[model samples]
Target: MINKNVFNKTKVSLIKINVAVVVSFFIIFSIFIYSYFKGLTYNSVDRNLNDELENITVQLTSSAIFSPIVLKDPSNMVYIYEGDRVKYYTRNGYFEDMLPKFRENKKNSFFTYTENGYTFRELSLEIGKYKIQIIRNIDAQINSFKQLIYVFVIGIIIAIIITYFIALYLTKKALIPIETAWNNQAKFVQDASHELRTPISIVSSKLESMLRSPNSTISDEVELIADAMKETRRIKKMINDLLCLTKEDSITTLNKEEVNIEQLINEISNDYLDIAEVQNKKFNINLNAENKIIITDKNKLRQLILIFIDNAFKYTNKNDIICINLTEEGRDIIISIEDSGIGIKDDEISNIFDRFFRSENVRSKDIDGSGIGLSIAKMLSTSLDIDISVKSKLNEFTKFNLIIHNK
Candidate 1:
């Protein structure tokens, strides 16, 4: 049940994570592939140059200086020499222009040279009676390598587009729960506003009627005054519950102390004993742990306990037994409130702690509730880092369990 606003926010967040992971992986993979391919091409070029140089040296050795050797024919590029005398040249001025520059360097190696705006790879060699030089134009291979660069760049762009779509699909699939929570939150706001409007309208209408009938004395319209007062109290209670839910610093601003658990339980039970008696119900307390002490926010803990007890009292019928049990297990104090009251449905149990959610059974009974008690309790439990759980059987009984750790 994701609303449009929450869905959009969750979608954006998920898309960012997906895009980051995909882009990082693609970038690393692309770099590795590009480097591997470039290395392979360079090694191939080196091997070809070595083989070509070897072949040219063999041709020079076979053709002795005494023999009339014709170099620089249709395909062969060779320069012949004997000591300081030049026997043959590849072309008119091919050797004369660059041979002096090549002689200045001691290293006999393969290198690139530019002549008249043309690029060539040259390898100079010394034989028995001839110095043969082999030259090969590498402009086409260089162009191919440039083409490879363009292909790699285009491949990266295409990969990014594919990854973007994949990331978008994954993000949508992963954010279902966020969408659901947002939808639930939207419904909660609508429900709360509906609940608030009822009491507010009643209060407004009653006050308006009373003002119109100014001649009516206190005795004449006591019922109207009393009904208005009741609506006002309900509005006040609802406002207080909303405040408890909305207060961001409730847990931080709490007055914490070492509370005597047994004493606190006894005091709360005693205070409710008279109310239980007036309602013709039995209030029971079973203290399984003796002289228990816990460091907690006493007032917040008291409010939590009262909320459970009050909820039990509100749903329980006359002659029903409402029981409070306190126990210690390991390093944690467990407090449970059990009541023989109208229980919650299995399906409804999951949503009981959501804001402004009341079961249909309770609503059918026309019970007076703002439906904010359990939501406030849930918020308080999270703020205090406590665990709270509820177990109930429909039309049978309900129990709330609170686990308070020993700090």
Candidate 2:
């Protein structure tokens, strides 16, 4: 399991990074959208004012009698000035006080003016001796632009809230594999230590027994010394197995070549035949596969087969039959190793490949094993793309089949 504090810190860091990136993108996008619409809103109003100014100028220069009532848009107001005096105006009564004082210097220009809470866009144009000003109320368009800003602010806030939860979810999902690997590593270390403790304790106790008999001759302590040496060799073998597993874990490449499958099996059978004769056991081999050549890591394949054959020898007594059979099934090769020995229970077969996992029957018989051999075999099988299956019944027989795809 991952530590609580470390997990939380890592999750928070990831969430913060994700949210920060989203927030920056949203803010920039919102600014661009707001500016584009704002420009469009004001440009429409300016274009309308320009059209009105042009119409007024054309009427004044056409020698037609200009009448304010002839204006098509009622919202627009026109004022004609001459020498700082209002000569003609569009609106009736004393509405001149509401309009700005006209100036001759301000010509062909547009500006915004607010008076008594009313906003207007004004255009000034000089025609002959007349100074003309055109004004339009723009309070509605201003209110609409303000609403657009409000929408963007609210939209950005909502998007950020959604992004926070999304970032949190994705961060947890990404860390699951890391957490699992860490927990597995912790368990592996714990199991390895537990397996090493027993042999070390036996060796230490044997040495202590010898030290107490210091006055005795070497012949008198022969059994004690032998026991200690046996345990020491067991410890050494366990260490080597552990080192092999660790190395296999770190390997990312395979040294593959064409290997004659029948020849490889015969070589292993020859070596184990000598062991069987010395131990008073029966050994047999049946090779029936026609296509014998396979492309794989030959050394790893040899080691895998040796693990199964060695286990058969360890678990069986005198006169027990151990057989290796190779046959072809379609385009795949199947290798079977069968032993009439102390077999495994049906329930324990599934867990035989776990590291340091020994069955109750094996433990009861006091078999000499570290229980890591099958685990290493499983790793090698996976690396070589070989599928393994087991069949066994307690106190009867055990069989393991390795399926090698020809492709």
Candidate 3:
């Protein structure tokens, strides 16, 4: 059984996980797109720089000069080369470093230089003694690439948020039918359970009277009928409990009125006191108040008490002691029933109230019960806004405490 608080938290956590996964996918896809575009832009810039430098170098070398000398246009990047000495130039002389490197060591026509996230590629050739080097402004190109990346990152984030909302919308649309199906299934089970209860009760009453008739003869057929009746009652009770398990708040036109708790407890205890004698057990009732009246439904509250008492007797061995105590606790009536029988085991305590959950120990003891007694009691107790708690130790004792609010 799951705790209500834990179940709620689990649901929220699952939703959070789903949202996180969707958001993460959105972010990742956006980043991939941004990187692809950034790379494409950088490649385009590099190609343009190379093409422009190659064109200017071809023109400058075509003209003959003395000593193979190179003239530096520390202005427009057009170089007139004469021989080996190379000088840098650009349209804006201050932007000379923007060009990529053209290295001399490889004799590979061009070489590259990198500084501050920028790559400078330079090429040089000689017509005379002066060797003019054409430098591409690599740093500025990279800086342009970086700016593009930043812009794309921002755009991607905005797009991802938008995508997240779309995903949420689609998921909600997909799950709407599931939620509706769950509601309908619950309603069907509740209606079916209610329909079964009346018929089962009628059959049980008829079986009872038939078994008690003076002319009735004990036979295998009669015993089989009794067994079948018991099974039918058991199934009916299970259905009732399953209906209760659903999340329907009974339209309880709860009529609240003043009632005497102490007198009610005393009366129930007295009614059951004679049963203990016939069954070879002990029943003790300790009432701490005279007229402990409060607002409640008399019939339902009485039914709840009877269920507990019935269970106490059903599972107990002969000669065991059962105690009922009624007391006032801070503006509330606390009714406790404690029984000394083969009490519930620690492992079985939580499931004891579950429908059709008969313990192995009880089964071994050969006790007869439909196993929905505590479930019905719990349902009624909850409807009446009463708190029910149980403390049971195997081979020691089992106790149920019912607290009713005075108001």
On lDDT, the leading prediction is: 2
The TM-scores of all predictions, comma-separated, are 0.70, 0.84, 0.49
Off by over 4 Å in 2: 63-83, 86-97, 100-136, 214-220, 248-250
TM-score for candidate 1, please give it: 0.70
CA-lDDT, candidates in order: 0.78, 0.86, 0.67
Q: What does candidate 3's lDDT look like per residue over 1-407, in tens digits?
A: 22446434644555566667766776777678767876676566446545666555655567454334243333225443333333433444334464434445734365556656546555555434545555555566567667867776776667657766665666566555655566556655554566456557767776776767857666634764776677686666656555654533651436677777877777788888789999999988888854477888887788789888888887687899898898887787788999998889889988886655678998788676656667677778878999999999888899999988777
Cα-based RMSD of the predictions, in order?
6.6, 3.6, 13.3
Clashing pairs in 1: 1-183
Q: Tell me the tens digit of each residue's lDDT in model 2 across 1-407.
A: 45879989999999999988998998899889888887886688778877777777776767445444245566778887766777666763324475665645656877776766777787888877888888787888778878988887898889889998999899999988888888878878888899889989999998999888889888999998899899999999999999988897543258999999999999989998889999999999999999999999899899999999999999998999999999999999999999999999988999999988999999998989898999999899998999999999888899999999989
Q: Count the backbone clashes (under 3 Å) in each candidate.
A: 1, 0, 41
If the candidates were sorted by their TM-score against the true structure, best first, what order would they fall in?
2, 1, 3
TM-score of 2: 0.84
